[model samples]
Target: MMLDDLSARPASVGLVAGWSFPATVFDPLVRQLPGDEVVAFDWSTFSSDWLGRGQEERAVPGLGPAVWVGWSLGGSLLLEAVRRGRIRPARLVLIQATPRFLAEDGWPGVSLGDWQGLRRAAGRQPVAAAAAFRRRFDLPNEPAPSAQLAATEGLDWLARLDLRSQLVSIEVPVDIWLAPDDPLVPVDWPKHLELPAHVHVHRFEQGGHAEWLDHAASLARSLVRPLADDPGARSAR
Candidate 1:
């Protein structure tokens, strides 16, 4: 976990990165965010205790009700945390995220064979497997060397966890950003799930899975707009 104090401004932003990639991969996007403080959580270190840790024991300290953002697998973790009453944020942003990653009876997602293949490869050769995974998504940065174990755990969670039924019950405001061209997450999957009235979905025409890499500035503006408009809004701590 890394915290960047951008300014003395009161607002803070917490970020969780996806599988295979390190938290530093969010540097570009974090630089563009308007928050005074930014906390980036690394999968390798944070995944182990994500659900077990208490609220005050979270990576972010004195981070009262900030805008929390998660991408890909990280988004699933965030959803799980919220569902379990782990962390509450003023707003939640999910990028290229889906409630479930593996294809179900009627859902569109990664095939079982492909998911299993990746899991096996990661078990045998994590570094090479992660490299191939990053190449497949055209991820911009290389993950830290210790991400091997975390990668396997992430795949397991992706295959086993499903949050479609939990979406409607979350009390926080959620903004889900989707890319129509994203190969990993199907844009049409949301149609199969029921979301709450506070949940809003936005689609971008370009930028595949790593939209933040291609459109960081635009995403930053969109992320801060609501906070800028409503400076007084605070989530339950």
Candidate 2:
């Protein structure tokens, strides 16, 4: 497992929670991590209540500018924080993230139909909406999400949002690990993502939206290696 491997490494980490995903989903990886090696972060437990008053910089104090491993929605929030100059991670690994989720005339993120359908489905029946999302986004090999809880989380996201325009301001070392087969946050989104000069990207052949969950340790290693090995080198961005 990724944790077993990272446990031996002498570095700090901050794992961001995926969209509509509970912290419990990460227990497998978190439980095995070196107690001092990584820390858990998310808007649910940390910033859910105190949010909007501004950003929370001390999300993980002892982690010492952690290497952020963000999946799905977490990736956007991580980028938002970085753009707002809120949380500063040592490095960022975006696992199947899209800078702009909704589609526009010129932009081809996700179609308005997709967003409308999601909203309508959620309005009609929360359980069905959650199931639809899970079936569409989470890979077949990934964990099954709780419909009720997931729907609630999704509602939260719909309420407070929009970090797309901030991409130009992100200054940290970012490596986006995309999934060629992702059915939800399509890979095309990243290829066209007009990010800051410091951002970077990597692609996966088969993993879906929850790509990192299927292989978090490998992803962690792949993403962190560059940052750990070349802190000052600063890749082509």
Best-performing candidate as measured by TM-score? 1
What's the number of clashes in each of the models?
0, 1
lDDT of 1 by residue, 106-130 (tens): 9999999999999999988887788
Candidate 1 at 19: error in angstroms?
A: 0.6
lDDT string for model 2 (1-237, tens) is 444554346367667666556655665556545667777665354345224454454545443446766666677767766665566677777767777666666655666677677777776776567667777664432345455445555444633455656665566677877766677677766546577767775665564666556555455455335544532222222
Question: What's model 2's TM-score?
Answer: 0.75
How close to the true structure is residue 147 of candidate 2, measured as C-alpha lDDT? 55
List pairs with backbone clashes in candidate 1.
none
Task: Mark the regions of model 2 whose C-alpha exceeds 4 Å error after superposition.
Answer: 1-10, 41-43, 46-50, 54-65, 137-164, 194-197, 227-237
Candidate 2 residue 155 C-alpha distance from true site, Å: 5.4
lDDT (CA) per prediction: 0.73, 0.60
Evaluated at residue 5, the lDDT of candidate 2 is 53
User: Cα lDDT for residue 235, model 1?
Assistant: 22
